[model samples]
Target: MGQVLFYKDLWKEEFWENPWELGGLIVIGLFTVTFLFFILFAVLFGLLFPSEQTENEE
Candidate 1:
């Protein structure tokens, strides 16, 4: 690993070594999970409450 960073090293960097680019995948995964949970809870609540009438409306 240290040889790659040396001035005389012939090899470049591996793909995973980039610092900034990796965070995008984590952020995207997090958002996707949140979105899926939002949809799931929306469905669950809609089924549980039926949305026909608010009981508190009376």
Candidate 2:
């Protein structure tokens, strides 16, 4: 238990030492994943099937 607490405290100190760097990396990763998700879906839908054209009556 003592070892665990010591490790936890160390981790907290390290995390607080440079929060901005970690936060920025997390935010960038999230955005990259999100952008890739939308792009993949858009491409999949775009290539899946063609849209049908309706005939106009005069």
Best by lDDT: 2
- What's the C-alpha lDDT at position 20 in model 2? 97
Q: What are the RMSD figures for all models against the true structure?
A: 8.2, 6.8
TM-score per prediction, in order, is 0.58, 0.56
- Model 2 per-residue lDDT tens digits across residues 1-58: 9999999999888886797978987999999999999999999998897566668633
Give the poorly placed runs of model 1, Cα more than 4 Å off: 1-13, 53-58
Q: Candidate 2 regions off by >4 Å?
A: 1-17, 56-58
Model 1 Cα lDDT, one tens digit per residue, 10-57:
333433466665677688999999999999999999889985668788
How many clashes show up in model 1? 0
Candidate lDDT (C-alpha), each:
0.75, 0.89
